[model samples]
Target: MLILQSVAGLLILPSLAWAISEDRKKARPRIAAVGVVSQLVVALMLEG
Candidate 1:
């Protein structure tokens, strides 16, 4: 759980940056999808 939390925190940076974006809304979704997948991978690694 702790490892998941830390990995989630790392993923938050890109989202926060995305949130701050004014004109790049379209690209944010793609970036977020990638972030989610990355977090999933991190969690999987912890489980394995």
Candidate 2:
């Protein structure tokens, strides 16, 4: 479970970067970042 959460965090970072770079829309990047942060938080919670 912990390993899966870590992998999810790793996957989300690149996707967030890609979304921020490719999309010109203002709200998309914010949404992507929020997703990334949410993943990180979940991962940390699981680890803790």
Candidate 3:
């Protein structure tokens, strides 16, 4: 779980930087998708 969270955080960090640099409204969906996938990964890891 910790590893999965760490990986997700690392992935999110770049997207967050990009989102901050550009218009957030346009990047919302992309960010959300990343979040969703990260959550799914964490869930799968925990279940397995």
Candidate 4:
């Protein structure tokens, strides 16, 4: 359950940051997606 929560947070936080950002023009969806993917990859690598 803890691990699941951690993963969910990793996925959701970046999206939430982008969603609530004041500068929508600067926070492109592609950048946010890339950040999320990179974070997930790093997390998985650390877990191993």
For lDDT, the strongest prediction is 4
Q: TM-score of every model?
A: 0.45, 0.49, 0.44, 0.65
- RMSD for all candidates, in order, please: 3.3, 5.0, 4.7, 1.9
Tell me how candidate 3 scores on lDDT.
Answer: 0.73
How far is 28's C-alpha from truth in model 2 (Å)? 0.7
lDDT tens digits, residue span 1-48, model 4? 998998789778877887888987787778777877888799789989
Residues 1-48, model 3: lDDT tens digits? 997887778678767776677575565667667876887788789989
lDDT of each: 0.76, 0.72, 0.73, 0.82
Error of 2 at 18 (Å): 4.2
Q: Residue 22 deviation, candidate 3, in Å? A: 18
Candidate 1 per-residue lDDT, tens place, 1-48, comes to 987877777778776877788867466577677877877798789889
> Which residue pairs in candidate 4 have backbone atoms (N, alpha carbon, C) closer than 3 angstroms, thus clashing?
none
Task: Compute the lDDT of residue 4 as modeled in candidate 4.
Answer: 95
Instruction: Order the candidate numbers by TM-score, best to worst.
Output: 4, 2, 1, 3
lDDT of 3 at 8: 78
Stretches off by above 4 angstroms in model 4 are none
- Residue 44's lDDT within candidate 4 is 88
Question: Model 3 compared with the native: what TM-score?
Answer: 0.44
Tens-digit lDDT string for candidate 2 (1-48): 977876776787666667777545545666766877787798689879
| lDDT of predicted model 1 | 0.76
lDDT minimum window of 10 residues, candidate 2: 22-31
Better candidate by lDDT, 2 or 4: 4
Predicted structure with the largest TM-score when compared to the true one: 4
